[model samples]
Target chain A: MTTLSLAPNPALRSPPSALRNTLTLARRELRDAVRSRWFLLYTLAFTVLGLAVSFVSAAGTGGSGLSGFGRTTAGLVNLVLLVVPLMALSAGAASIASDRERGMLSYLFSQPMNPSELLLGKFLGLAAALLAAISLGLGSCALILAWKGLRTNPQSMFWLCGLAFMLALGMLSVGMLISTLARRASVAVGTGIFVWLMLVFVSDLALMAGAVALRLRIETLFAASLVNPLQVFKMWSLHAVDANLDVLGPAGLYAVEEYGALLHVMFAGCMVAWVVVPLLLASVVLSRRSPL
Target chain B: MNRLRLLAAVASLLACVPAQATQPDHAAPSADAPTTSTVPTTLGEIGRRVAAAEPGATLVIEPGVYHEHLRLTKPLTIRAGGKVIIDGGGSGDIVEITGPDVTFQGFTVRNTGIDLDKENAAIRVLAPRAVIKDNIVEDVLFGIDLREAPDSLISNNRIGGKALDIARRGDGLRLWRSDRTIVEDNVIHDGRDAILWYSKGVVVRRNTGLDSRYGLHLMFSDDVTITDNEFTRNSVGIYLMYSTGVEIAGNRLIQNRGPSGYGLGLKETDRFVVRGNLMVGNRSGIYIDGSPLAPDVPGEFSANTLAGNDVGITFLPSARGNLIYANNFIDNFNQIAVAGRGNLDANQFWKGDAGNFWSDYTGYDQNHDGVGDFVHESATLFEDLMDREPSLRLFLFSPAQQAVEFVGRAVPAVRPEPKFTDEVPLMRPVPVAALPASSSSTRMPLAAGGAILVLFGSGLLRLVRDPAGGPGGAL
Candidate 1:
């Protein structure tokens, strides 16, 4: 019985009561996130990205309305790939690992609350924070585009931001797993950054090289790539604009012709797996390691 | 081989065939009539009239529906009074011209049978010096089939084919062995192709072909000039096979994304020139295979904008002696690709000091010259790999592709020999048509929304000063 005693007992509470506790923790985590420097930095990075988009568009370079809009949005995809993952990874890795580093998680777990509840609560709160950050980022972008009197599509902007948010959610779950496993906060963060680099840079190259070397079937090669969250995000981002996937060349055409509508479902399933499976594994590991 | 019923049609006997009665000159149907013929009649009834009509005689028909197939056996003029409709009853050719110097105009010819083997058409011309203009041909298996008809002028015709599979649809405008023909201002859609087979000295301009199999398919057709034509949303735009002395200029070829999907494809052709053309959003902007088929007859491609294509200017091993300069290759997925195991070293990349502009060219021009200081190479390690294995293109939009290129560049040993290099690559894109600018009307709403979000963000930032500070230091 400690600071944990203030929280409800997990054993005696009904399902609804457990839900209430999870919401309470989620609300507290969200409030804390708002006050955190990480959130501030995350929001700043997105705002800077928005600024870059506007300035580039304002220069009157890309030309025409839709073409200019398309070109700028394509550029935004590359930047979002870098920032979204980094934000989600840092926020998630530090949330549990840093608190556990100070032995605060242990004190909180002194109550009858299950470790899974805390994990789920933190995830939901962090997801909400990232979404808010993304919205503000896109909002700033729209403002600048409109202010410069540049023609743009709101649906495309929303689509790109939505995809970025989904990427952040998936990366955040992986970060939580890293946080759960690594005992030290710095070590967890280091690991998270390394994982980010692997996902962002190394993994795709390796898969491409391996696929070529093995002469793997296109279906198999593409299926293997779906496991990587970044790859999934990249595929979806391209898919949104390119209806027939002509940009990806033969492979894109093959994807559309073969899977048709099922391709989206397959990608969506992989994204959900990235979000849910890692968080569940992290919670299981945390429960086992920090036994009540 | 169709039914031939010839009536002794005289110059003065207007609508004298069968039971058709002639109208008075003042009672002519249309105000746009070129001549003073007082006949509003059926083609089935006037088969004998057409056969017996004197050479160079003018025939005017009333503006009404005529469900009959007619054949022209004399050098006569058959013009519509107004909006004359000729329904072919879905069986045979609607109007077949077998004599030279026939002028057929101002008729809506439709409902040819879907019998490909029979080669049925709305109008089949087997004569020379024919003027076929100002007509609307729809539900046709074949629009206008000109066989051995030279010096013909076909213009201002809208030809729409039947709603059949692309393979089953007949050519919209088929010119076979017809020389020195001028085909212009025709809109042909939903057909197989507008083909010119062995038709030499042909000038095809101002034609628009949409949603067709091939826009203008030239097979063994020499000395052709195709200009100011737009062929979009088709299987292949303008394919020249075994043709020589051809000029393809000022054409807009967009989104020809069929299976082959080449905006402009040339195979075994020589002494060809392509300039001032807009090739955009195609699967491949220009695909060359065995071009410059002759030893010294080089193909010249200049001042064309090939943008937003999946693959631009693909070359086969047999393709050589091509002078490619002053073209803008921009925003393509894969700018240049070799179809098989070969390089494009045989082709000439530049003409003297002027070279083409590459959007991906990274060299800087320090002397303010339009030319890049360094040579531009199309080959990159990532692109090379992607060409070898098409599936590697899946990672093209991802950062991992850049990493591979970075690694390839870092290691000097792994740097590849580009398929072709431009020694005098243009630093700036040659200005084509200026881009249109549009002003956004959502400015006020967007600005207000941005202001609100900024305020919200500022409010959120103020919370960072809270004494709690939280566990963010670890982040």
Candidate 2:
């Protein structure tokens, strides 16, 4: 009690300390990311193939079918769906789980660096690699979409890439969550991939089945559509392309026209929920758990 | 009055001259005609004459296998006899229309080889108001490629291609950016798709699309009405993408046989009215994707009976504000898949609105009220995690999910009560096709607004940044 001073700690007020710590963590992550052979290989292979396909198609190698914005969209979608997800997931899944599996995380935690530093470092490392791979594909698409007196739809382009990035972040965070819970590196990776697929394909199928079984009408379909990230992604993508054209078929068209104003907000709201709820739960789960 | 009647008769008779002379299938050519006459006997001679025709003349080809490229440049009508063949000699694009008002009909164009560099169409019409009808275009990459030109009619054609072995080939009739085109009464098969487009004002009717990627694909199109067609044995029968004002009615979507099959898939489309269509024997009857695109349009699903499908209807996002009314969902793998946001309630039809008829409706309508006593609100903890991990759907029937659904439904406090009805849902499917082509007359104002948006988005960004930076202002 006597030793405990009635004064504030200097460390709490020192801005340089936090900044220095952040920079140090970032630098360390950069070093680790640069050293990762697997990420490098994956990014390089994806970028090369992506650029080649874009160039060949743009050069009119496969007729006018694969020319112009169609080629660009295909290339971008392929990259986002296949390449970006892989890079982000693999990097994140192995970061903590591998450390724990090798009994290295305990040693690192024992050091002066705090949990914030370690987590931030790992995230930054994975994010850097992900950004690099995504940037390569994005640059290629940009080059193709840009021409003399011809421009791609800015809304479609931005939303496509933005949603992909958001999806990547969500995947990476999920992988990290799996890493925190798993006892082995391989187990975490498998779990992460399985989770990814379920999110990508299965959840929507199940919700659809539920809707059918219950005889849920359009509002229910709309409500249940939010549970699937793919639907959310599609909604955002369609909205970005043309708010007017997002509604298809008898039900969708009617929903948009009749309840024209609310559809956009509803779509946007679903997308935000998809991003936020998962993140918040993951954060809580991670915060409540032990590092090792 | 007698003089006027005589003049009218003369004008009518002059019109009949072209029709009678062009009917080579029924009428034989005159024996006095020369082989190399300006009214060309072979397609090669017709090609030459068409290229050198006056503004208002006609270049007619007689029945024969003319192995040449018929390229037209003037405002002329190139008519071919029923047995007339424009063989490509293993080259590409037998007939090329590059002029306005060019009409080629009653021909048997064949054997256009595959080229990776150039998409070889049997007849590639690049002119406005071009008509390619009643033609047998075979073994070509694209049968009739109408690009950018508007007001073309491609009807009564038998178009097909040999298996290209999945090297990304074949589109039977592709109209891109060509407005007010009518594609009707065609038998198209063994192609990527029967009809594919990115244009407006297309009326596709009475066609048979078989063994194709998509039977009818309307992408970025508007004011399209697809009626009285048959889509069979295709991967996806009908696929609409980023389109609006599409009315699909009186069509039979038959067995779309595929490895991973789907009858119809509507992706990023809006203002579509699908009614009185028969969807039968497929993996999925209709899949409406709510993925994001620019200029977003909401979806409306109604009045189409989905029967004899592996899966009845699957809504990816259950929470999306889609209206599903008056649909008869009968005997399938499952009824509806509401996988997204929002709520679900048992639809009450007699309250002036009708919900989809699921074959699996179990709740009793007590007191003969016709409305089910129980309201089905889709709330499961697995769905909550589905937002985080979508793969959960595969394991949706797992013990964990069952437990969660049971416990979650029991605990009303935690369960999400998704409301499935609008107080004023549509009484019936909107008659979009019947809604006169008012979009065109009203489109000028919209186009003006669009031009303004583009000018502001594209032009103003530079003007405000000129003083700040040079080319970097684009960022």
Candidate 3:
């Protein structure tokens, strides 16, 4: 008789309210991002870099009328690899740490919002900003290609955009983790930059050094590269654009032979993990810590 | 009437020389036997007929698929009229010749056995003075195998292997212990290597190889000349291993991007001349490892164009006595990558006022002598660190590397010793005569594109400065 009654719980009915609060928080974060001039700086930098790469590639091809879309995308890939992660890290780390430093986080916590919802809202907002900036930058290149009547593979462009966004998300998650761990905004920013340098640049060097010192096979070098999210992104992005793994050097060829198209799926999975694991850790930390 | 007679006389004169040249080298022409005869259908029948044919007789074969292994003992000419296919049925050599002075022409040979130990080939010659011309060999383990077949000619043949992995495929054209051979004007692709092993005095000219392992691999083969050949998209364009007295000139090696990614790899080779060659779009244009074999011996590299490669040249610590001069080093990621604490200063970088042209050189030629007054040194602390730690390659051409370089320049104490220095660096690019015409033809488009890029960049810079000028004022 006691187990016979099954009714919708009042807490389960408040999903719409939770969704509305998340949207509102996301909107507020987006507004703050715009007000800080970070969005403008990102868009401007991307457009300029995109145009410059296209121009250089076109010129390098003997001005064959910008038909060298492959070269243009290739050049942009390196630029995106270097610059996007830094932008995402800085923007994402500042998003929470700056708010927390200004006592806004404490005020928000008092207003009936849970830590998960706040973190989710902030992540969604930061991710949206990053996507917008990337689209603008890459869109400028596409516009140039279209204006010049250049022959470009649309699928490649889509993949590039997707990979770049995923890369930004991964970097953002790392930044948010740092934001939650650090007590001060400056500390968070500093840690974010150092992490970017270590992951994006130093990790590859360290792997290569290890390989050389240990006399490891090229396969091991490729396997080691998978541990670094940026390396995974670079490999996946390059492989996606260019079917010829030979251009990736020895390690690239080995990866192609070992994983084939599965490498792309694996890299995507790693990127998702990169986004999820850090966010989960940050959420746990945020929930436990007392707001100042 | 007089002009027609004169033309006929000239034509006959030209035809007689080749006819005499095609005659068997050691055998006299048989007067009783017919000069030419058509072969019967089926592989067994052709082999029997060829054996029965007189020495120096020309056997003409009709177009058909002959699934059999053929062995010829008589010195004769085997000519196929049309699309004559000699398939090995996936076993043994397609055609094996033990007879001297045999000529093979105009046939499609394919599908030799996949036994590496047997060294199966579409066509194998064990005797001397054989000529294989104008034949198409496909889907074989080895396209053509010349074993102790001295003074042979392999020309105008299209040779390819099974479209398998490079390791599984055999050499397209292999010469073992063969001396004084000529391999010219042949198109080869998708094979392991066109190799010369223990072969002496080989001339490989005007051959084209693409999508293969090694375009031309010379190992323990001395006094070889490889000229006027083109290799594209191969593992290694031309690999010289433990070979000496090799002359590699006028060869176009382009875009040979593979696992090793070398256009040319020289190991333990000496007394070589590499001149007027074009090496472009490779990972490393030239990888020199322990070259110059002896203390007194030296290899000469001059008037070559090394452009658009990741590293123009990479030298191992043991490499010495190499003379590198008057080459165009254009648009390479790094001019040179030296392993260990190697000093390239001992190697010659200049011949008097003539030196290599580096695109990155910023020194001015104030005297208008076509050479910069300041020395061009290929030394950077960043590059040195990159050599020590290969992982630093991820930051190649990055602003951080550039910043460190700037600081290194400002502070002399941090500057590493120069790897190589050109006392007289060319202010302008190399002369048009020294460079390949293909490179020159591509330069115009690059120049035009660069100009447009500059204009677009400046315009974008302006737009960034004035948000109102940007499209939609979004920024």
Under CAPRI classification, how is model 2 graded? incorrect
**Proportion of native contacts in model 3?**
0.02
Using DockQ as the measure, which candidate wins?
1
Which is better, 1 or 2, measured by DockQ? Answer: 1
Query: All candidates' lDDT scores?
Result: 0.77, 0.58, 0.74
Per-residue CA lDDT of candidate 2, range B324-439, in tens?
A: 56665554434454434433333222234455544444455555544445543333455554432322333332333445566677888867544243333222222222211222
Per-residue CA lDDT of model 3 for A47-157, tens digit only, reads 798888766654443322213344466577777878889989988787678778888788778876698888988888777777767766776666565555555455666
Candidate 1 regions with alpha-carbon error over 4 angstroms: A1-27, A46-74, A102-118, A136-154, A181-184, A280-292, B1-66, B80-84, B88-92, B433-475
Native contacts, share recovered per candidate: 0.28, 0.00, 0.02
lDDT of 1 by residue, B371-400 (tens): 999999876888888666666777876777
Off by over 4 Å in 2: A1-292, B1-43, B49-55, B58-60, B194-197, B257-260, B291-298, B339-351, B365-475
Task: Please write out the lDDT profile of model 3 over residues B1-475, one tens digit for every residue.
Answer: 5553443333223211211222232122112211111222355867877868999999999989987778877789999989899888888678887789999999999888886655567888888999999999999988988888999999999998887876577789988778999999999999888888789999999999999978898878999999989999987899888898999998988788744667888878888999988888787789888788886867899888887676788887778888888888776667887865667866778887788887667688777998898999977777887666544454443344555677678899989888888888887656423234432233333333434433443443343235432222322
Worst ten in a row by lDDT for model 2 chain A: A1-10
Residue B453, candidate 2: alpha-carbon lDDT: 34
- In candidate 1, what are the lDDT values of residues A1-292, reduced to their tens digit? 0132234434325557657667556655666788778888878888897688677645433232223354456566767777889889988888788878778888768756789888988898788788778777876876787777654445566667788889999999999999999888898899999999988887877888788789876657667788888878877877775555645655565566566688778888999899989999999899889632
